[model samples]
Target: MADKAAAQEFDILILGGGSGGYAAALRSVELGFSVGLIEKGKLGGTCLHNGCIPTKALLHSAEIAENAKTASKYGINATFDSIDMTAVNSYKDNIIAGKFRGLQGLIKSKGITVIEGEGKLTSEKTIEVNGETYTGKNIILATGSYSRSLPGLEIGGKVITSDQALKMDTVPKSAVILGGGVIGVEFASVWNSFGVDVTIVEGLPSLVPNEDAAIIKQLERAYKKRGIKFSTGIFFDNVQQNDDGVVVTLADGKKFEADLLLVAVGRGPVTANLGYEEAGLTMDRGFVITNERLHTGVGNVYAVGDIVPGLQLAHRGFQQGIFVAEEIAGLKPVVVDDANIPKVTYCEPEIASVGLTEAKAKDKLGAENVEIQEYNLAGNGKTSILGSSGLIKMVREKDGPIVGVHMIGARIGEQIGEAQLIVNWEAYPEDIASLIHAHPTQNEALGEAAMALAGKPLHG
Candidate 1:
């Protein structure tokens, strides 16, 4: 009910210009709607600025360092020098800067108004920023997330989170990672390749517990071989930091001391103090609760990205943003199942999976109603040539369609495109088997698994 005379109005108003917000703006504009995007930080938000882009750049640098360390094994004479942190960080910054510039250009080219300031929801369809009101017919909430910590475990000094880890000028000599989720495992891989002694403590029984059990086994084996130590099924009791380092004591009285301790537990939704409750939007445990269609139960309001729960991924945010825009445009976008969303952990041996796990499939269907086929990468000519080992496991309803595909190997994350298509499209094993994968490629392993599931094993 504030005066509308001085307020800016648009067809769509987006909050938090992250993956979801920016994507919603772009898509809405493309659909011939006037859009206004408000952001507190850089346009890219956490994914581009802190979380995804920067971390992936570090992971790629880690891969280069690892490859150099093993260059002699490939019959190439090259000295593996110590990692130059300055140079490595420069590379990461360069990539981020370029992407940031491009995003700014795209926003400008799309003719969307970009407002720079913190925005608070004043009503169901209005956001107040810097003493100015922005109103839209439809509003999309895409406030992202932040790194989370435990009750007593604080992040300061040597006890850090991924955000701090990303900004560190020098890699620690030794580090203890608090969680074994995607973020934890990724940092562990990077630090290990940088010659740090890394130990991961996971509360679950296995690292990357969300992945298929077989994939977890392979990852553990690979981590062990890389000398990356991990303690699973143990909970940390407390953490103490001193002049020397940080010590993490487990519930069972075991202690681990390292130069730094990284708390990679998970990310929590940043829905606090944003006036969501004031706007009558329901929230649970800090996450905004949205319906299958992403409605916020409020008039003309929708939520997307990490705040909306389900998969806390940037790409998922992108999809949801686009979907919400299309829905607002009366396009009636198809609802995507969260289970069909592809997940990839960029650790040493990357773990990528789409659709249900074997256990989940068996639980959903009867154990006898599902069939699983695992094709070892050892049989794949490309993997063997690269001296890497992994497996591609496909899960399907008995004599029905392929419901899941899980993979673990070097550069295997690239194959999730085909895997997700197969699962999301509900393609039968025989359907994929009829297709051809090029010779001596890592992708051939997926095709091999499909063929084996189709009852014709080319190279079992």
Candidate 2:
């Protein structure tokens, strides 16, 4: 250690102790590089405090609520009870708290210097935090994101965002959710299960617009059956909130008045006044521009996670962090494309996919050079026993490897691991079909789809 008069020096200095930053810190230390991690708030960041972990916890609680109501169908005598937000919040908070504590311990064990306070990139290799200066050979910007709202529409009172939605103690009787993306639909499922009348407004043609068409249609069907109303292909014109409630109007002059309006539009990167642009890094609408290898092209600076303008997933950030650390160590890891990343939606009827959609595959390989096959979950014994119905669609090159896999159903997200491996490894249908799948398992549906694609259909 140098004299206290000089700034602390490190091999790698990271701003933002979120999933990505902390991950890079951990890995960098393991590679024998001294690391300095900086954070303004909690170490776990949005994914742990507000985004993935908390939202998924609420979704799980919603699942239990749904299961309780439908328990009679399974011959189980159970009385459905009301939701207690205080209790629910406690449970969710506990999960996050435990994880946060574990993360803190892990970082401490790794011996990385976790600088706790707001940090800004003063230069390519230096960061200033809380009246202190830390210089490093390399720098990483992992500043995450925040809940975004439409222009001219404020977020307060009756008009709230996911952050407020998670902390709500009293449940609203009716809620009009704006935007039908992942956040919108997931909240819809949760609120609906909690006995609230929920309606979603989406400008896209269907719910989960980025998903496969088949999955979208299946989700629409399930939402309709579940009494979750949605107005698709219509843009919201205006929203006005008062002490009583909110009135949401559409472009076509349709109005939905509800006790609250949830603006589930999306999240915007948090790279505003952290001195990124001042340091000469490329910026696009608050997102930092990075190369395929995640370098900023200005010195040894790099940016990862939500600020990089690709997928804003926690795992994606985690992997990128590891990749950046390994890259700095000269390990030269195999590049992971955004397309190969697995996407999972934790709604009532979950959706999961990896690689291309059918349209995308056909577009990439030409329609004639591609092949498609699907296996309905109705025929799967496990799905039938669970009283769920959906299907798995597989996209492939003609006489070649599987290029994509999309699925929708109860707990279908659990099947994404196998699908991701198949797509990422470019496995042929026969290769998966040749493997034995346990009977009466949800995983059997994937194997059945593979079998069909291999010209050896078995109970498809």
Expressed as tens digits, the lDDT of each residue in 26-80 for candidate 2 is: 9999999988899999998999999999999999999999889999999999988
Question: Could you estimate the TM-score for every candidate?
Answer: 0.98, 0.98
State each candidate's clash count: 0, 0
User: Residue by residue across 1-460, what tens digits does model 1's lDDT show?
Assistant: 4445434898999999999999999999999999999999999999998999999999999998988988999998887789899999899999999999999999999999998999999999799999988898999999999999999787788899989898888979999999999999999999999999999999889999898999999999999999999999988899888899988899999999999999999999999999999999999999999899998989999999999878999999999999999999998999856989999999879999999899999999989999999998988899888888899999999989999999999889999999999999999999999999999899988888999999999865
lDDT of each: 0.93, 0.93
lDDT for model 1: 0.93
Instruction: Give residue 263's error in model 2 in angstroms.
Output: 0.8
Native-structure RMSD, model 1: 1.5
- Give candidate 2 misplaced runs (Cα > 4 Å): 5-7
Give Cα distance to truth, residue 196, candidate 1, Å: 0.4
Query: What are the candidates' C-alpha RMSDs?
Result: 1.5, 1.1
